[model samples]
Target: MEMCNEDKSNDDTQELSLRDKFSKLFNELEHCEKEEQKQKIEETNRLMEEMDKEEFKSFIGYWKEMKCVWSLHFGETSLSKSLKKTIIDEEKRREGKNEKLLVELCECYLFLINTISAELMPICIPCLIKVALKKEESEEAQNEVETALMVMSSAGYWEFMEQELYLNEIKEIIQYHQEYHNLKRLAYQSAWQFLINRLFNDNNLEGMIVNELCFVREAARELDELLCCVDWKREIEREEVIALMRWFQTLALYFEFCHLWNEGYAELISIIVKAFRASRDDHREISKQCIHLLRKAAEIEVIKINDLLKGGAVDLIFEEILQSTSNGEILCDCLNFYLMISRKLKRMEDFKTYEPKRKLIKKEIFEKMEKEGYEDIIISLHETFNYLSKEYFIHLPINISDYFVNV
Candidate 1:
């Protein structure tokens, strides 16, 4: 028996030497057909079984090389429908076994996901996730699912984020369920539950550590990404977006109360601007909220118009409000923001010189008022503004006059 073990160990050592000799030649691997390469790898792996322990472990290095090679191949030729079809078929082949393979495929895909630019991901991830979700006991599958969720959330695909995707058992078996980048998904889910509790479920907070599922970076990034995608001309679901806007503000308020200033500050200001630009249906309320935030930012100098204009932000805002659903409060806010933006730009080297900002303000207010059949209110508002302007200055001259006279 001792001699037999010695013989086996010797055989393993010899095989290890051979695989190690060939492993460095990975780049030239593409010349061979994929199936031929895979077959060769299998033969090598089989031979490795005779190798010593250290040699046998070199499969990991081989696996890594294969992944790099396959990834590049996947790039040069996008996943064929046949391959995707096979992946899907393999996924459905069993009650469960495909999960292991699915997970492995996902890990491979994730490496590429991190390496490639974003546009490619939308094409690949859905395919990857569809397979991963079929497996029940797959940690790798769960990981892939999480990464997919991360990309989805960060990309501001809210409808996708709202879906409860994991298999029931996966969620149950997960001892530590809240992974990184999945927190915003968790938060959105929890908030939905909070709504449901008011409807049919328990209104209890005991079971849900809602904050545990709170992914700060994901939410922050999603908001930032969405703001960048804010196109004033495109038709979008304004209500859903407004809800998202409110969710961000609520998150900011929560963070503020907890003294999480760093987490809340940037996105809070960003969401306010985005909310204004995104405002459509509940625009009266939304615009009012925007004005409230703009005023606050002005006081703090958190988001100045100069900074906004530098980012081409003012144009988007103008286009957004020009198309807003008219209401009393929104109208009032539009007028006030017009005044505020005018004042801010008045000194800016870029826009301070543009008469259109002031002209647009005057033109827009009357256009909106006229469109809304609020001519009487417009006239009244103008008269009220003039009266207040006079009254405001009534005390202005008297301020330094007495002191000058005394001097």
Candidate 2:
């Protein structure tokens, strides 16, 4: 009985020792200088590695509890003030080492987010934002901004939108990045996260997000300039081309939800059609995005059939279908888009509007399909037309497939 009591006492003492070690580590991490904090992080990692998995998990839980209590006591405002001062001091110092220190400081805050209280968000968010929005032209500064944006993205906090000034500052940064070809990819990623978070929460920022920042009225003009500048045939490095295409695709997606289609529909369609035609096999991803955006535009009725035909979208669609016979997904999308066009034209017949122009375009499309040896496409369209005829009881002014069959 005495041995068992002694064993229990030993276990209690060991548990207390472990608790003390954890508390010491947390306090050191919280209050240490940036370099010391990094060392503490390494120490903490080593300690975690030495612990059993279950013990380590328990330690994490305890750490989170303690951090939450600390955050509540110190408050987010106080934390933000301290962090802002550190950032300003680091910026003013302009030492090469200061960049690393700034990143480390930001990382510390990022790590704290896992345990930080919601009320502390205002403090943490603004600090990261100021760091991201700081106007330094150095590569390190760019990296810092990217890192801060990445950290903010990981937090996935839409509450930042509540601060109008901060939100606009972020928007301006995104807009500024959009003008530089090299930085545009990160800009797009940041914009996507920012816009999507707000969209998911149903927060509207329509009036503030405009042409140069989000959607440009002269998208076609810009696309044409890009095409002229890039010799798609000779440009073996497809990264820039692909990135530009993705930027346009993201813009189309953003416009879809915002009902801002009229803002750039014509230009978007024109650019997508051109991309579909110019993209090489190495750029199959770009081609796929083009098809996806086209399909989306068609489904939303953002790009009218007339506009599509005017943009020669049908010709490009048939070209992709013929070129990608073995690509089942692309083939499927092509067939689906063809069906949408047919249905749209059939609906237009109700108005007896542009009937001749529509018939002429349909004849031209099927003729091109037959000439291009898209017999499978003709068969699919024939089947689809018969099904639609029976389902909708709509009469075709002309036997659509008959044109393909005769050709």
Candidate 3:
């Protein structure tokens, strides 16, 4: 009984010692420079390595409970508000030092999160995101959001972060901050991290992750809006054109991967056709992206390809684009679009049900391409496509083929 009492006393003393040491180290981490903080992290890692499994588990539980570790002493909800208020009210703003404390606090929080086990992420991530989603465009706020996105993008947390709710959070972040380049880039990284894992590993794309949360249809809507709102009559700024080109590439990726096709896709094709007509002569890069997206859209017949035929998209390509541009890239994409059309025409030629599509492609695409002196390219591509179709088994969903019968 005496030995038991002594053992209990020793345990209590060790607990106190750990608490004291952690508190002291936390404070030092909060104040230290970057290199010094790295050293402290090494010390912390060594300390963790020295503990047995049970001791390490107990340490993690205690570490998670500490408010200072999260930099959320006033609570998670109020941390950003308080920091913003401090920046606004402080005389340190005049010296350009107002954000110093916030930066240091973010660094300390990052350090703590990096050191903690990924299993503890549920507790850590929500608080980090609360700070990250700070509506301000301040450098410190950007830093916080970037760090959170980087952590979310990292492979270690992907198993937990791939949940639908978290993916929605990433989408919302992107939807809200379309103007901030760094934020958009990192947010896209997080979103792709979730997508690429599910795509290659599971090979399953059912549920909201693909249909709604994948942002494919949503991106089509946004691109449609961008195309409609741009003043095509005037010379667009170079940066604006470049940004538009990037958006085109992004939407192309969505059309390639996400298979769900809706009315938004038809609208996207119509608007892109219009935008292509306006930009093809002036912006080769944008024209190329538009044609490339059209080719991808053609490959996946999940959507109504009739929309492209009806929109006079083929006429615009043959009449204006081929006549105006000498760019090899633009010509290459144009030829690819023609090749895709030929393949479609070949597939539908034998079926009486697809006679309307056959006539439409013949009139809008093949005749026009032949008129434009692309007869040899068209004939050779068809021969190649015919051989490949016979040799290769292209598996498509039954529903996709059924859906095409009506269009």
State each candidate's clash count.
3, 0, 0
Estimate every model's Cα lDDT from 0 to 1.
0.41, 0.56, 0.51
Residue 103, candidate 1: Cα error in Å is 35
TM-score quality measure for candidate 2? 0.54
Candidate 3 lDDT by residue in tens digits, 1-407? 00010112436546544434544554465455567867876776777666667555433422322121333222222333343344334423556553545443443344333233343344444544565566676875765665555444333322434343354555566556544544544344444443444443333453454554545554555556666766777877543564465466456555665566654556667767777767766766677677777767777767554766665566655554435434545544555565566566667877999898578656655455556665544343443444433343322222222222232
- The runs of at least 3 residues in candidate 2 whose Cα sits more than 4 Å from the true structure, single-residue gaps closed, are 1-125, 150-166, 174-185, 207-249, 347-376, 380-407
lDDT for 245 (candidate 2): 55
TM-score of each: 0.28, 0.54, 0.49
- Report model 1's TM-score to 2 decimal places: 0.28
- Locate the minimum summed-lDDT window of 10 residues in model 1: 1-10
- Over 4 Å off in model 3, which ranges? 1-161, 171-217, 228-239, 349-352, 355-407
lDDT of each residue in 213-310, candidate 2, tens digit only? 54444345555566666666664443365346545545554546554435456666777788767774556766777777676666565467666766
User: Which digits, one per residue and each the tens of the lDDT, describe model 1 over residues 1-407?
Assistant: 00010112335545435544444333334446667656655765566666676665433322332222233453432333234444556556656556556544544443332243343334444443454234344565544454433322222111122223322322332213334332333334333322222211222321222343333433455556555665545644443444454454544333322321233444445555666656644344555566554543433333444444443334433444455344444444444444555444444435655556645544543454455544343343554454444543311121221111111
Which 10-residue window in model 2 sums to the lowest lDDT? 1-10
